[model samples]
Target: MIEFALPDVGEGLTEAEVVAWHVVVGDVVEVNDVLVEIETAKSVVELPSPAAGTIATVHVDEGTTVDVGSALVTIDDGAGAGDVETEDEEPLVLVGRAPAAAEPRRVRLGASRPSDPPGPGPVIGHRTDAGPRVRTKPPVRLLAKRLGVDLHTVTPSSGDVVSRQDVEAAAALTSEPPVSAVADARETRTPIKGVRKATAAAMTRSAFTAPHVTEWLTVDVTRTMELVHRLRADRAWRDVRLTPLVFVARAFLLAVRRFPEINARWDDEAQEIVVPHFVNLGIATATPRGLLVPNIKDSHLLDLAGLAHAIDALVQSARAGTTPPAEMARGTITITNIGALGVDAGTPILNPGEAAILAFGAVRDMPWVVDGQIIIRKVTQLAMSFDHRLVDGELGSRVLTEVGRLLSDPGETFLHV
Candidate 1:
């Protein structure tokens, strides 16, 4: 029997919520066949079977979040599969691809003897004081144990069965006030997990650790709008979805090239300001799951058309919640387009480990003075937030000024390109 424990899918990932299971007990599976889908703090990923076999037992149910080394399922993969030797115990074989960082717990399977008859216990449906003997599954019981929550004290919101949510809610009340502490009866409690929880933790760390300074610049983007119009008219560019954001991204890349220091990180351990030649430009995207900041790799090397295409693809993938975990990692700088939601401006927070982030505000037609004459011009507000530990006021101002200049006049952008 091959015990399949949940593997660590990415760096620093300790646990994942089981979104679904494709194969149940008694189902046959081949190597590399999709076995289950689990959602981590980063993204939703499908895990494949490491060995071909018939699934003997499903240890975890859907919607249960478990640690990396927790047993997920057991498969009867014939008799030839090798086993890892252990001290004074029966030979056990775990999933081949399980991360070495987390060792699967040794599980003793079945009864010690055939006549033992499933151990001595009060059977299910046997009545107790608190109705039907506190109905719950193994996974829920395990969760309750981990959270220091007693099942008898939890009230089941969904029918009679105690769910994972119930366990989490009960735990929340004991620690830092969440479910039971609500003052209003109309309020609903949501367990923070997956993307929401990850975002909160990251933002909190970034806010407290880094000294953030945000600068704003409102610029006349008439020339940038003209460039967009011309691109729309061109037959070659018709296939591409051209927006002000594409221009903003292109301009930002140019500015980063001019001020590479803005595209760097502060390594406190090494006591160094590390600057990489390549730029992984992150685009902040809002999805059904949560806010995701998936980035494009080597964005500095891409031309305007390529950059546009890359941004489109990245945003689409992020919104659809299909973006790979790697795409969301290693971002040098970030851009959040609050304009898409019609917000005028915002002081955005820096993505953790990134030196800077740009928040592009909504474009509007406003009166401006040109050669001592008032005229209507296309204008937008640009706000940038940078880590003051790495970027001084002058450097941050220069980067923002360069970006504003490129947007004000597209010809300058072309020359820089």
Candidate 2:
């Protein structure tokens, strides 16, 4: 019998709330077949199976938040009723078929596991006195239990040893979560597990640890506002959602190129400054569940239109809770559009692992100095917070100044290629 344990989805996610199960016991499944859908900190991911066989048992009920290495399902490879090594002491084997049953349980969202507390737990799998006995690779281990695959009975075809394919093969033999489990309750709470929990802890640590320095500058972005209006009226941006945020993103991207040091991270471990050449632009979005900063992988490579589309897609996905785990990782820079909430400006917190964050304030018609004369112009404030460890006052000021310049005179500054 193969035992499938939940894998780390991404961003160090330890456990996830089983939003759904696509496979059940007695069902024939193939490798790469989606076994379950789990909700992590930032998104809902469909976990694929690892092995091909008959699902003997499902340890977790739908909506239950299982720990990372907790048994999700058992797969029987029809290897005959002989001596088999199973995680459980019962030592079950691949016998004939059996009738399926349902188990109901409640799960909490954003909650921690009992065994793995805030501090420490098993890194990959549980360790016993006998020895280390995890069946899958790091990635495969993450995929196994997530897809509800049993690893013990899974045959590793790869000459190199256990791979994600083996775990996926084991998952193909299962059916969806039981219908009775779905009807058990309309609402459930899953404690934050895995990446979600880790993100929370990191954010909390950063918030309290960093003595944040926020500086705000209100600029008369009449020209930028005019460009947005023109773009909206143009046929090129007809389908796209033309908003100030798009221009803000573009401006920040360009400004980062001018002041590259701001687009870096402080590595306290190595006592070094890590600067990135490319930009993974993160947009802070408020979802129904919580705050998520899903980013464009390579924002530097995208044009204004591409950036707008990417931002739109990311925001929509985040709000719907469908953003992928991969999209939320490796962000070098971040932006929070606080203006959407009608706020003028805010001292936004920096995302962990990144050195700086830009807060785009609300764009509104306000009296401003234009050519030394007071005039009603489209005005907005830009607030920036940077890590003092990597970004000194001069670099932060230069980056913020460049962004202000671009916004104030977008026509003069060329769009970042």
Candidate 3:
């Protein structure tokens, strides 16, 4: 029997919630067939069977969050079935809250060290005589034990004491109605997991760590709007998906190319600036799951039509929750289209590990001074927030200037392309 442990589907994701199972005990499955869907910090990923086999056991129930090496299922492929075994280590026990003598040790399959606990939540339960005791009521302690939760793993919602609600909340990381979640119909409680949880952590880290500087520019984009209409009418471009966003994406790419230094990251570890020649342009997309910034790889290499198609496909996949984890990695810079929701402008936070992010606001008809004459023109606002450590105000302003110039007169910008 092959014991299938939960795998790290995303980049170093320690745990994932078992969103769904595609097979059950005694069911036949083929190699590469999807066995389950597990949601990591970034996205939902489908795990495929490693070997053709009959499902022998589903160790983890749906809605449970399991560590990367925790046993998820067992499959028998005409091979001998045996008891699931653990690594060469002591039987796992909950630290701070020792299990009773009669209770059996729950062995996590791939646990290497006691610190590497194999269950779920903040810290998995493992045998250790160290660490401060987590304060909780006896009934809450019993509840944690029954649900296989470690008291040390649950972060107390209020102060130091862990309540029954905290225990239940830990159990329902990805599933179940949050116990005592409603004090009244006036309020609702949602378990922070999957995308939402990850977004909060990332945004917090970015907001506090990076010294951010924001710059704004307003430009008349009458020519860019005219170009969009012309492209829609053109036979060659009729089939291509085009929008103001596509133009904005193109303009951002051009600006980055002009100022390659802007497409760099501050490597604090190495104490150096790391710049890549290639640009993985990330588009901030709002999905049902959450905000996903799945990027287009080598966007600098694609032409206008190709970029439009890529942008459309990326947005559609993100909204449908089908974007792969790899597509969301290694983003150098980003663009958030707040205009899609009719917002004027926003100070977009820099995507973690990125140097800058641009916010594109709604394009509207506004009075503009052209040749010293006030007239109505298609205008829009652009705002960019950049890491002040890597991007000085002058460098950031120059990049924004180029982007605005390109968007204001895209026909001239394309002439060179």
Task: Output the number of the TM-score-best candidate.
Answer: 3
- TM-score of each candidate? 0.76, 0.72, 0.77
Off by over 4 Å in 1: 80-185, 412-417
lDDT of each: 0.79, 0.72, 0.78
Clashes of each: 0, 54, 0
Give me the overall lDDT of model 2: 0.72
Write model 1 residue lDDT over 1-417, tens digit each, in one string.
677788767668899988656665545676666677787887777777766666656778666899987888776666433562111132122224432222222223322422223656532222234333467654455456546677888999989999889999899888543322233467646578888899999999999999999999999999999989888899998888888998999999999998899999999899999999989999999985689999999999887788888999999877655677788888999999999999989999999999999999999999999999999999999999999999999999999999999899887464234
Error of 2 at 161 (Å): 41
- Model 1 TM-score is 0.76
Show where candidate 2 strays beyond 4 Å: 81-199, 412-416
- By lDDT, rank the candidates, best first: 1, 3, 2
Per-residue CA lDDT of candidate 2, range 1-417, in tens?
567777766767676777656655445565556666676666777666565555556677655777777777765545543543344432222223323322212223223433223575333212222432334433344456556565555677866466766766667777643222232347534445544575688788888766577788888899999888888898966988878899989999988887788888877788888887889999999875578898999898888888888999999888766777888899999999999999998988889888899999899998987689998999999999987877788888888988999889999353446
Cα deviation of 171, candidate 1, in Å = 28
**Ranking, TM-score, top scorer first:** 3, 1, 2
Candidate 3 clashing pairs, residues 3+ apart or interchain: none
How far in Å is the alpha carbon of 199 misplaced in model 1?
Answer: 0.6
Residue-by-residue lDDT tens digits, candidate 3, 199-311? 89999999999999999999899999999988899998889988999999999999999999999998999999999999999999997568999999999999888898899
